[model samples]
Target: MSWIYLDNNATTKMASEVLDAMLPFLQESYGNASSVQHRIGREANQAVALAREQIAQKLHVKESEIFFNSGATEGINTVLRGIAHAYARKGKHIITCQTEHKAVLSTCAQLERTGVEITYLPVNKTGEIALQMLRDSIRPDTILVCIMAANNESGIIHPISAIAEICQEKDVLFFCDATQLVGKQEIDLQRIPIDILTFSAHKFHGPTGVGVLYVRRKRKPIQIPPLISGGQQENGFRGGTLNVAPIVGCGKALIMTNLHPEIEQYRDELEKQIKLQIPEIMIHGEHAQRLSNTSFIAFRHIKAAEIMTALPHIALSSGSACTSGLLDPSHVLKAMAVSDDDAFASVRFSLSKFTTKAEVEETINDLAKAVSRLRSSSPAWQLFKDGLIS
Candidate 1:
């Protein structure tokens, strides 16, 4: 059986082009990027510089403004630590949404121990934060506002532009976690007044172990304390020897895959087919703008994990990878006011450029079969069959 992968949001298979680009660095040019005395070290440094340039170009920011970290988690930690430590005097209060990744939510939770106050803004039924709620939450002591550009579970795109405008009016620094949005959607930093942005390369078919954080240069002199204190690196914000190979691979992957249009086309076709086959399935974020390559659907009376286990030839997820093992419903869905039944029955299907229409059709057919089988045994369906009064 040919296994189809629909869990692009969890992590993507490393692109062949990305692996090819990193082969030299991994095998031949293995050296510390900070070293200047050896040829290998110089080559690694050069590779790191080039990757920074590529990421900067993508974000429409200066190369100096972009910093490489281990991944989105690390990047987010750095941002939280930096703002909490450097701007502690400015304010001890931060605001974020309840649906943010654990990386962001947990970081804020940790900050609370150090006298930082945090308010988790609520999302609407569509899993989106209202701009007015953000405006209402801003206080004189509000130092920063953090929100994800796209949700990992529902693939819902948040109104970062409107939030940015609100932040600007309040003179509050805004940090956006764009891990799921960076390469999947078009990002123009110039048009959006975001103070900080974070993304991981693996989300875009690049290798893991590399992520980028963009800090707006024009922001008020906010000092961010280092997460890893060491020799001068990442402009002293993050201190550690850079991983040159993965960074090089990440840059190449972004340039190669993100520029291709076929990925978008594939996603459109998948959405169309699934809707045609399963009209009763409720699509999360259907009413709002979302990432083109992602879809979240809940099959009534079918357990998501049951469907996943039954389709062993397919790789898919219920929600975020970080929360995969937990039997509880996704916090994202809960924040969107989704009922327990819908949350447990939802599955996320994310497509990449490599996902073929054949695979999509096969997936749809398999899903229909799985849902039918599960529903036949479901207690809810049995109750409906008994002709119980509505």
Candidate 2:
């Protein structure tokens, strides 16, 4: 059976170019990046440095600002926990949105247990935090404002530029979890003014286990204490022997990323067809600007689990892959004022640069059949047909 992958937001398929770029480092050139005394080690260090430069150049950031790490989870933890510890004297308060990834939310929760005050800004029905609310939430003690560039589930893009400006005006550090936005959108550090940002490689056809943490080094030169303290790996910010192969792969993947404007067309077509076939479905974040590769839709009376079980050949998600196994509804949908039933019914279909129009058409047919078949059996769906519920 042929498979159609629509879970790019969760992780993308590694590109052949990225694998080719990483093979040398993984096989013969295997050496500790820190052990530069030997030729192989020097070569490894050089490769890592080139990888950093590639990423920096692609993202329009300085080379020194880029630090490689395990992934976005580590990067988020490094920024949040590191700031909480390093800047504790300045303030004990931080602000973040309620729909943030588990990395940001979990880190904030942990910080709260340690006596740090955290304010979770709520979103509207379209998954957007109000700029006025954000401006009002800033207290004198607020040190950091954490928000993502794009949501993992709904693909709703927060007003990152405006949010950064607000944080700048308030003199608070701003950290953007751009894991879902990095390759899908252009992030020019020179223009955005975001103090810190994090993104993973696997989200953009790079190998997993390696990612970037970009800390602004110019202008105000924000510095948080090192999250890991060892023998000066990652400029002493993260201390461990570098995973050179994946880093090289990440660089290649980033450099190879070319925004596919046509992806939005495909996504729009899919949503249009899905809505025509399944009128009871509600498209989450439909009013807001979202990533071109994503569509989050909820069938009113059919649960997402039923749809997934029916369409086993399609690779998609009910929500964030990290929390998909949990019985509870998605925190993202709940934050957007979605009903518990709607949240459970929501499904995310994220495309990639490599996704073709034919695959999208196939997916539409599969989804329509699955939804119709499921709704046929659902008693609640029958009640809706009988005009019992809206």
Candidate 3:
């Protein structure tokens, strides 16, 4: 009765290396980063600096460009609010997609209350926004365009590079929520013209309550008002005391994931096996480039929640963890024009570097049996059996 955990997207198991990195900070090195006089404060500040450097090294950006936040949700809110307040004179218009995380969408809605106009670009059937549509969405007053690098539910990767180019040509600031893609994919900030990028360390093997936001140094400094006004932490962009322990752990986890690159292949094999074993399952966002570790599958004639209950030996999700308990279909699926039936039956399987071939095999076997049982008892199957094919 060994349990398999396949919900990396929801959260990851903290890596041992990360835990080791944080141990000192939690015990012997417990000191406020903002303090100046004490040796403890100096040591804590040094650790924070090193963590910043490590995060910057992975993103290929300068140390000064990275800022730590509570998580991706905060990072997103900071950018949206910062941009709206800072660039209100430039334009009241903002552009994003319907598939964006609730963090981004909700922040945009909040901005709307303050008079900022928002345009949610529609995605194609493949769960990707058209480049031309993004290009057309930009107006003279468009201040920013926020789009996620990889969808949290469907695992679809957006055309960020193209979107960056469109923003660059139009001089519109580009913000990317890379929570699902960072550590799982290569993000060369030097090569890409991204103004702002957000990542949650927990998405990888890092500890929770740690996130990174990369602001392009070369881009013009947008006067983003502070979200939390207090001490001069995070260059005054984000205030209050920094969480040094989790930030250090996040840095260590990121470094470890980067060192071991073969996890991508493991994820690919898992997806291949699941597809082969259950060919009838409709794979959402199949036509687009997606995160290697994620697979969103819909078991037709079977409820996703029921399948989840039946497969207690494995841990997975129906969609985004934040929105899982709700009965509504994933906004990402709905944006891609997925039918209500397919959306309701969908399940998200996100693997990790620690996942093994044996585990994947076991998952496929269990899922196949579960789907078969559910389908056997399905009213849709009975209707089809009675010659009501339509």
Candidate 4:
């Protein structure tokens, strides 16, 4: 009757446990983390240290390797820009896929203006890039390979482990945008060994405005020039008064993270029901490995905006929240070679751990009715029904 939120990829409701952990820092523990001379400052510093340790433990990384920032966007900018500047002498070439988040793509675009050579790899219909193509794209001058572990729109999971191995063999640094991968699955940096990774707390039921950047140092050190220059903080990697409350919240959120199988079941059931009840619907990335909680569906002949408008009580997304306001079709869908009409028709429903079967069932019914009603007034749908168009 009120709202059925299925936009978890855009952001999640902060977990009560995370909020509880952050309260003390926001109130009684409020002190300058940089001021270590006083007791309050020492307490703040200890909380930050504990939070960092918690995140490190969850990621199977060292505390010294973790750096906190505003969120994944800032971390991405920091990594791409820092690498471009820090490794310019080594090589000005970077390799990344076209489906990367706007943060990565835009940063690469900016670097291109500065005479940096960026190779944008193409992905197949399933949104998975050919590993051989990636290997071939890597030149002797390639300093870094940047990619996302999971796509935010279609939820397609790339073969990051293989990509890592290829980069490792080539002795090139790799940066993974794991914002969509974090908290949804277990990550052991020791096993996969990504050169650098970044994630946002808000993507995993933690507070907004906080994120982590993991820089590898066990095998070969990664030197990233600071993006923000001010007082020495985050080991001089990020300079600012640490966001004590959100940092504490982020750590607690990561510690409490766990895989939810039932959410996947709900998502699958929702998709199955929608397909069974409605005709001419296509599931994007259905054949590929994807995040369990995401479902991107395109109802042919019906615009995604119209669908969302029909189901007013449900929270849904046409594409990435960052790019939603733009009238163009989703770039992610376009990259997968989807028709422009289907790209415009696509809707992303990202379930959270809190999503329930009852809500999912209700949504199926509501969506089916909305689509049927809209299609009745649509000439395109009539053409599709008559087999005049597909």
lDDT winner: 4
Per residue, candidate 2 scores C-alpha lDDT tens digits across 1-390 of: 579999999999999989999999989999988889998899999999999999999889889989999999999998999899888988999999999999889889999999999999999999999999999999998999999999999999998999999998989999999999988888898899899999999999999999999999866567677788888887778888899999999999999998898899999999999978887889999989999999999998888988999999999899998998899999999999999999999999999988999999999998888888889899999999999987
Q: What is the lDDT of residue 98 in candidate 4?
A: 95
lDDT of 4: 0.93
Candidate RMSDs in order: 1.8, 1.1, 1.6, 0.9
In model 2, which regions exceed 4 Å deviation?
218-221
Per-residue alpha-carbon lDDT of model 1 for 1-390, expressed as tens digits?
Answer: 798998999888888878989999989999899996999999999999999898778778889888888899998998888888888777899999999999999899899988999999998888878788889999999999999999988888888999999999899999999999887777999899999998999999899889888888873565677778988988887888888899998888777755556666776666677777764578887888888778888886678889999899999889999988888899998888888888998999888877887888788889878877887887886775676621
User: Which sections of candidate 4 miss by over 4 Å?
Assistant: 218-220
Clashing pairs in 4: none
Count clashing pairs, candidate 4: 0
The CA lDDT of each predicted structure is 0.86, 0.92, 0.87, 0.93
lDDT (Cα, tens digit) per residue for candidate 3, span 171-229: 88899999998888888888888999999999988989989988887635766677778
What is the lDDT for 151 in model 3?
A: 92
Regarding lDDT, does 1 or 2 come out ahead? 2
Ranking under lDDT, best-scoring first? 4, 2, 3, 1
Best by TM-score: 4
Lowest summed-lDDT stretch of 10 residues in model 2? 218-227
lDDT for model 2, on a 0 to 1 scale?
0.92
TM-score of 2: 0.98
**Hey, what RMSD does candidate 1 come out at?**
1.8
